[model samples]
Structure formats: C-alpha cells, structure tokens
Target: MTSLSSEMSEPGANPLDTVERLALANDWAFHRQSDDELAAEIAGQWCNYKLWFSWHPELGVMQLSCALDIKVPAKKREKSYTLLALANEKLWVGHFDIWSEEAVPVFRHALLFRDGNNASIELMEDLIDIAVTECERFYPAFQFVFWGGKEPHEAIVAAMLETEGEA
Candidate 1:
C-alpha cells in the first residue's frame, strides 16, 4: 500500500516559527496541505483526523473505543474522525469539531503519520505541513496532528508522533 506520513505546522513548519498550544495562535494556515497542484493531485483518499480525550489512566494511553471520562470543557471539548481528501480539503479545518456524546481516548499520535505507511507517510507529511501552516492563520483554536500509526485503519491505531505532554 502506498503509505506515507508527515508533520503539519503553521507557516510551513519553518522550525524557527514557534507555536504553543496555550499561547495565542499566530497568523498561519490550518489545513495540512497547501500547494494547489498537490492539493488537486491528492484526489484520492489520503488522511483521517481524530481528536478526543484519553481516559485510561492505568493504560497511560486511552483508545477511543474505551477512553475514560475527563472534564473536557463543554465548549472546548469535541472531536472528529475526518478522512482527508482532495475535493473536501480546505485551507483550514473551518469550525472546531464537536465532542461525541461519550468520552473517547485523546489523540496521542500525529494526524497522518502512521508507522507502516512509509511511502504514504513521507509524502503526506509534506503536504499536511503546508496545509496546516495555512490553517493556523484561520483556525487558531484547532490543533494539527497526524493519524495514530502507519497501520492500515483496519489495524490497531499507531503513532507517527505521540501526543506527549509539554514539559
């Protein structure tokens, strides 16, 4: 399978540009990919994004299926499992996702970077970063992340980049 991974950062992942979750977002794009050509090229299915809270404290990490209940702010707490595509792809995430009725595991990995999808992961990351940077300018509240792992969606969720806490 043509699998790949990438990291999305506002301002095209300059590395120099600093972005912190708690801090007010900067002027940037929110979408994961940018280039007009690339955007159009990815006409096929490419990415899926899921956001939630991790509940299994004993497990240390919670899976969406059995996430523990946490005090997710009524307004700020929400999640979605979006499949990234070309036609639907936007410069930004648009509106923040609304939480599901039940508590689910928090996003612990990058949005698109899975472990086995080496081919897809590499290519996708490049695109995701470009889009994400642009998204920041619009959606300052949304956070950019990758799919859990390279494992096909059928397999268990994995992590390209684990959502570790800030030190």
Candidate 2:
C-alpha cells in the first residue's frame, strides 16, 4: 500500500479509483467474528446471518455487516451493497442490488454505478471477497460471469477513462 500522498502525486490516478483500482491493497483490513459475538452485538434487533468482512481506509471505515438480507430466489429482491467512496468525503453510500432468481443464491454480473464503469479492476478482488462471503452465508455458488479477470468486466476495469453506466 503506497502512501495516500504517493497516489495523489500521480496524474493518471482517478479519485474514485483509489480503492476500486488498487493492484496491491495491503492496507485494507478484514475481520471475522464468532456467533457469540454476534448474539451479543445485536441482542434485540432482528438478526440476519449475512455477515460482512471489509476494508475501507479512504472511506474511514471498512465495516461489513451480515445484518442485512441475502435476497434469495423464488422472487427477486434488491440487496443494497455498501461501497465506500473518497470523493472529498470518507463515506459514500453506494449500492449494488442482488436480485433473487430461481436459485437460492444467484449473483448476476451487474455493475450498479453510473459513474463507476471505468477502471474498476481493483474492485474485482474486493467484490470477489464479498461474493465469497455471501456464498458462505447462503450455501450456494456465485453465478460468475467474469471471475478470471476477463472481458466486458476487465474492459471496463482497464479503461483509463469512465464509461456509460445507465445514462
């Protein structure tokens, strides 16, 4: 993990790409809590086992919560995925919706940001990590479209400039 100032000096580095375009994001942090800890934390509130493990330095926090729904099939539901942003602020509420299918856990390769279409390869690893966590919770597999650093996905990630999302 290079110093923030180091990246700041680079002319080509995009502000939004800092966390999402990282090649070696060694500074990011992750944690795994036990069921006892969970029970103690959310004793009264409704409990959902969609656990979260995350790392967000520029966003000032890298917290993940299994405190939400996994959006299982039988009917499609939207899952709000929290993504950190560093556009002059530490925290930004970004989202990606996982719509349920006939399968219990089917993750469609859908990028949910209008301005986040370019240079997102760094997010791949992060997304993979999150998806892996989701898989663990749901006892299912990811309906992976571009798992091995491949196209449309890779093209969007590799581009030096931003592309259209939904405009």
Candidate 3:
C-alpha cells in the first residue's frame, strides 16, 4: 500500500492566515485566537453557524468544524446519532457529528496541503459553502427528530425531498 507521507510533501505554512482573510472578505464576525486557531460566525437561513479552524503545520493539515446552532438534549441523543449517521452517508466530503460537551451538531472536514500546496481563497470559500449547505439541508431533520417525534428514517426522508419550483 502507498503511504500517505510518500504522497504528501513537506509543510511549513499556516492555513489559518488564509482562513482569516476569507473570513474578513465575507464580512463575517470572526476571531483569530492565535496563529494556529481562528473562529467565525456565519448566518444561514435556519440559524447561525459557528466555524472553527485549526492549522497543524507539522502535520500539514487544516481542520474545520462548523457547528449548528441547535442543541441535542440527553433524551434525544440516540435519535440524533441515528440521524447524523444517515446524513453523513449522503455526504461526499465531511461528516456530521454531535459535539458531546456542548451537545451541538457540527460538520467537520480536513484539508491536506503537502509539497508546497497552499490553500486558495476559492478553496476556502468552497469549504465554508459546502459545510453550511449540508447543515442547512439537514437542520430540519434534527428538529423533526427532536421536537416532531419523527423517526430517524422518516425525518431523513422528509428533509431530503427537493421541490422543483415555487408555487
């Protein structure tokens, strides 16, 4: 099997710089906690999302997690897990997860930049776009399961339906 390190190259750049610039360009409220960490808040149709970015220079990886505003109660945790599993299955990149400490759901993904590969503004934009879109697509499912008393499968079905045109 080919090793990941072999496929990758040496890294020395920090991706948080790019992320900070992207956050500012969009006029989003953001904080640069440190050279390696940044946080931003974005408004969506359903609710606001908290985006956190961490850059690992040694590992040559940048990780992003976008947390939804909704929270999962202890009683609804099981159903939320099931819903997350179903939602993650439909995604090509990133996965949905419950942040246990905060009991909030988040979409997480990572980018590997090796051999002098740097993150472009377009790439950062796409990363944020995809995360928010996926969260919006499934926000109702979480609500359905927690408050509407719908089963995970049923909620998934309802949330996944696409309307072709406006009435």
Candidate 4:
C-alpha cells in the first residue's frame, strides 16, 4: 500500500477509481457521484440501505456512512435517542445516530490511513459488512420503540430475546 500513495501523488491518481474497481469486483452496484465520492445500495437482512463513501486523498481518510430505511417519528424522538445511546455502546468500530434535520437513523464509520498508506478492497468491504450487520442486528429494536410502543429498555430486551420451539 505504501507504493500506492506514492503513485497517487503522481499527476493523475483518482482514488475513486480504486473504489469503483473494488465495487465491481465484488459485484456490488455503485455510482460515482464525483471524482471523490461514490454511492451504493445494498440489501441487508432487515432492509435495504444506501451507502455513501467519500475519499480524501490529501487527508488519507475514507468516510463511510450508511442510511437505514427506518425513520423515527417526531413523537418518538426521545425514545429513539435512548435506544441509539444503548446501541452505540456495544458498537466498537461505528456508532448509530439520528440526523436531526431529517430525523433519520444513520450508521457511520471512518478509515484512516497513515502517511504513504492506501485503501484496500478488503478494508472497504469489511467496513460495509460491519455497518450492515449492525443495522440488521438492531432493526427490530427500533421498530419496537416506534411502532410497538415499548420503552427503550423493553424494546431492546425483546429484540434481543431468542425464542425456541418455532412452528
């Protein structure tokens, strides 16, 4: 990866192209928004999500964000906050959040590369996997708070419960 940054420093090195190639190799559908930005839609266990990634070659950082389909009702904003706080606690790499302007839930994570380091396909794929898995794992919890009319604690507990003897 060290050689990669050096090559990028040359006249024409498009970081977004590296991202596009990886997305194609993985057979994931994606669109290039600009020279520095790319977006993709992925299907998760509970719902589909839109992922946006921006590459800052100067800073050697990649910012990845995923927007879940669930939206918190205006009336349930407080409950949503409590649930997000609980969910964010267990997540080590990324955290769940509510976008105040839209009242939508989002999961975000960032990858920082040291000087001379470049982004790898594996790293990008893993980041997306983590975000999707976390969102699916907690989808039911949010549903409980918003539609089931359950308190935050009750919602999480019920969502985490495992039932046996299924029909």
Candidate 5:
C-alpha cells in the first residue's frame, strides 16, 4: 500500500490527475486512457480488481467501478443478482451491481465536485480502499453461490460469519 497525501485538489482541477498520481505512487498497473479516463488493476487478498475511473468534467463528477475478476455464469446470474442486492444493503458508501453485458460484479461509487468544491486526496484514497475492502469482504459469498451451489442468503450468512479470536 502507498501513503496518500492529505492535501486536497484545487477547485476545477481534474480529479483523474489525482487518481493517476495515486496509482503511480502505489505502483499499481494503470493506464491513463484519456484526459478523463483512467484504468488500474489492484491485487487484493481474494482477487485482482479492475478499477475504472471516469471523470466527467462537465458534470464535475468522477465515477469509479471496481470489478472482480470472476464472472457469473448465465445459470448463476439470478442468484448472483440476489447476492449483490443483499451485499449492497450492507454498504454505507457504494453499491455492488452485476454489469449485465460483462456478467461481472462491480462495486460502484461516484464523487461530486460541483460548485467549485475541491476533492481531497484522502477522499480518493478512501474511495479506493472502500471499494477493494467491500469486494474482498463479499467475494466468498459470490464464490459460494456460483461454485459451492449455495443459496444466496445462505452464502451471505456463511461469508459474513466472523470467528471470535485468533487460533
């Protein structure tokens, strides 16, 4: 992990610039696709996450999608959708959704920088951290539903179970 600056970006600055800096600082695999787009791959405990950041300068909104490496098969899509709904209910910041075209689950969030307000580096860091953390936390539920043949609710319960102490 890389240490992020505590500074806030200047108003009217493209947020993707900050994102690019963060990606470089962390040594994550990344590409600056355009002035408004950035894509990065981050390795997590459960899987590698594909992160896409899109900056809409006109709207002053930056959208991020952190996608899991696994794809939900057609037969498992219904259950996966259910699991996504249940998982999203637990999140305070972002929500998980299955990208219909890709059949991949992604954690999505957006930050608004309209009205000349600045975006803090801490906020950007938190956005990435939260997305990865949520994805890691819920990965097993998807696995259980897809591969373990468990029901969505059951998978959620099983994945969310926490042991009391270290062995």
Candidate 6:
C-alpha cells in the first residue's frame, strides 16, 4: 500500500509532523514532547540512542540532538575530546561533542531555511537520516576510546573504515 509519505514530503508541510508519521510507518517509537519538539528512541546496529528534535517554525530552523550517554572516564576525558575533534573533522553535516557537565557525548546538527520559511519534509528526513547514520557509523569508536583504551587517531580510523555487510 502506498502511504501518505509522498504527500507529507511536500514543501510547507510541518517537519515535526512528517517525522511523527514516518516514525510510525517504520514502527519506531516516538513521543511528541511539545508543539515544536519530538523525541525518538532508535535502536541502531551498534546500540540505541535517544534523538530529540526541536524545530522553530518562526525561524525555520531545526536542531536534532542525540545523546550517546557514553560517559568518558575522568582519566580518559582528554582522549574523548581528541576523538571528538577528529571525528568532527570528517563530518560534513553534523558533528559530535561531549557535554562537559555530564561527560556525555552528543551528536548535533542544525538546518536552516532561507527567509524563515518552513522546511520541506524531504529535508527533515534527510536530517534525521544523517543523524542516525553517522551515529551508528561512529559509535564504536567512542566505545573503543572509552573502554578499549584505543588511541583517538586509531579509533577514528577504525570508525571511518567502511565494512561490507548487510544493512
């Protein structure tokens, strides 16, 4: 059955609503946290992460934030910082960083529309896709740094290496 996914992709559609519909169609769990925000927990290949999206219609800007919840050991904080810096350099759309107060690393990206116009659903979907895909791709590097005692450069190289497998 053809879903309303195409219709929802039209410009001027509410990005948040589009996300909600897509999430349901994909059987993913999500919650509408507010008129302008939605939270989704995605179970990924390596691990799970909670993604929170905030959209400001007036400004036509959206921010997607995901908390990896992998705390950097106090002793390894410098390595964590180094890893993040290296990882971010390879990223074109989004970047990863540690939340200093909590020692939790977060992946964040922002989208801005020209002249305060609403974003098309396709753009919204693309934003979410990048967030999840990048997180899944590089999560293990964080693990290696925090747990496996791997050096930052080595961990990033391991993360950036493409593996052939079924998705």
Using TM-score, give the best candidate's number: 5
**TM-score for each model:** 0.20, 0.22, 0.91, 0.83, 0.96, 0.84
lDDT score of residue 105 within candidate 3:
94
The digit string of per-residue lDDT tens for model 2 on 75-136 reads 22221111101110221222223433322322222233322233244454455445434333
Error of 6 at 135 (Å): 0.8
Q: Write the per-residue lDDT of candidate 5 for residues 41-105, one digit (tens) a residue.
A: 99999999999999999899999999999999899988888998899888999899988889999
TM-score winner, 4 or 5: 5
Candidate 1, residue 73: the lDDT equals: 37
> How would you encode candidate 3's per-residue C-alpha lDDT over 1-167 as one tens digit per residue?
11111121224557777677767667889999999899999999999999999988788899999999988978999989899999999999999999989999999999998777877666777788999999999999999998899999999999999999899
Q: Give the alpha-carbon lDDT of every model.
A: 0.26, 0.30, 0.86, 0.78, 0.91, 0.79
lDDT of 4 by residue, 1-167 (tens): 11122223223344466667666766677999888899988877788888888878677677888888888999999999999998888788889988887777889987776654555555555677898888888889999999899998988888778778978
Candidate 5 — worst ten consecutive residues by lDDT sum? Answer: 115-124
Stronger candidate by lDDT (1 vs 3): 3
In model 3, which runs have C-alpha deviations exceeding 4 angstroms? Answer: 1-11
Error of 4 at 52 (Å): 0.8
What would the C-alpha RMSD of candidate 1 be, to one decimal place? 18.4
Residue 66 of candidate 3: its Cα lDDT?
95
lDDT score of residue 86 within candidate 3 = 96
Q: What digit string (tens of lDDT, one per residue) describes model 1 on residues 3-46?
A: 22244443223221112111113222223232211111111122
Candidate 4, superposed: residue stretches over 4 Å from native: 1-15, 162-167
Query: Which runs in model 5 stand beyond 4 Å of their true positions?
Result: none
The C-alpha RMSD of each candidate to the native structure, in angstroms, is 18.4, 17.2, 6.6, 4.9, 1.1, 3.0
